[model samples]
Target: MKAIVLGTLMAAVAATGATFSKSAEANELALSLCTYVQGDDTMRMRKKLRDSRVRVRDIYSGIQCNGQSLLQFAMSNGSQDIGEFIVGRLSVDELKSSGDYEWAQSNGHAGSPIAAAIKERAGL
Candidate 1:
């Protein structure tokens, strides 16, 4: 179901030359992730979180707005459920080793999924 929806979205976007948003810069998976974050589509994101097509590793580093991560972007955009969901799914090493994660860490962002979850939970 997730794959089908993603494929359809990809095909439709490609055919229409439509972009998910101005902030996505036409990145395929980024568009999906961004939308998944903002659209409250938890079902699709659960599958895509580990999907190679979504490139979770690569997305770790993309900073659409002032170096905010997908998780950060999502929660801020009012998708707390999705943010917490993905954060709970990912491991510390996976989040840390991703090229962008360390950068975000250095920049004072929560670089670990669990940590981010904690921070959000504490209302920090």
Candidate 2:
């Protein structure tokens, strides 16, 4: 009985460790994605997402780069390619609900190409 209990505890600990490891990896990926956006490295960003087998649409809402959403961060950093890429990847409903267009207009990015992309994607 004691041996069985020990095995169970070990299994639980291993599972918990694996969960934390996955969470850490996710955080690292998020950081890398944000850095790529800030640097306007669309190719690397695409590669990272593809290699990780994660879609932008899946992770976009969960990622906040310096208190801004990925789209907002891209626009603020003048990352037009990445901004458009992200827009293309997201669904129309996601685009509309993201409020990115309004954020752009309010943040003085109304004239930016990214703002235009947001407007088009969001159908505003």
Candidate 3:
């Protein structure tokens, strides 16, 4: 069996914050810009955006992990800044089909950014 992956990365996570690894393979080391969103750090997100144009739009509009889009992940996890950014970037169809916007809306999560941003746009 593979190594049990047990030790808490919590301290490191709390120190650096959200989804990271040390001494990873080259492929694994290629960081995702969505990480900043997942981290809920606008400053780091903006910094990453300025630093590289690589997967930003695709990640914002389309990328998915474990049955959820970046927007889905952001909203589910209460990352509003990132969710608002995703709201600005993604199309309605994209949100409907891929970003979990519909689920979030119907689920009545008061803190869900997808629902909140759309409602805000409509001046509700």
Candidate 4:
């Protein structure tokens, strides 16, 4: 029984990974850039995202490249951790004034996983 349970858990994890793999490509790229920002490449990522051609907002609206952006990748994957790092480093105003906040409060995504993370770090 224990072996069966472990196998089932592993299978579930694998399936979840597969599902996340199918997520929007732009969102995924944005998340990757977020990770890079959270890592040591904040400057490079910021510059890249700032380019007019980079429109992560289309994938998940309410994302603007101002220093105020609270954009994040999918929480179930590695994006959440990177997001947390970026949130910790960003200023309070940036966190509070992010488009994610408006979208979360106005839309039904109030407790959205990513928004929740931003709020938690931003102290909003």
Which scores better on TM-score, 1 or 3? Answer: 3
CA RMSD (A), model 3: 11.6
List ranges where model 3 is wrong by over 4 Å.
Answer: 1-31, 106-111, 119-124
Residue pairs in candidate 4 whose N, alpha carbon or C atoms collide under 3 angstroms: none
Best of the candidates, TM-score:
2
**Model 2 TM-score, 2 decimals:** 0.96
Give the per-residue lDDT digits (tens) of candidate 3, residues 38-113: 7887677666666655445454543454456666677767888877876676555555555254667665665565
Residue 75 lDDT in candidate 3: 72
lDDT of each: 0.60, 0.93, 0.58, 0.56
Query: What lDDT tens digits, residue by residue, belong to model 1 across residues 14-109?
Result: 866644453345365566767887886888876665564444544566536335667667645667677677665555565554433344356455
Error of 2 at 81 (Å): 1.1
Tell me how far the alpha carbon of residue 115 in candidate 1 is from the true structure, in angstroms, after superposition: 6.9
What local lDDT does model 4 show for residue 115?
A: 66
* RMSD each, Å: 11.7, 0.9, 11.6, 14.4
Span of 10 residues, lowest total lDDT, candidate 2: 114-123
Model 3 lowest lDDT segment of ten: 21-30
Cα-based TM-score, every candidate: 0.47, 0.96, 0.55, 0.36
Off by over 4 Å in 1: 1-26, 47-58, 63-67, 93-116, 119-124
Best by lDDT: 2
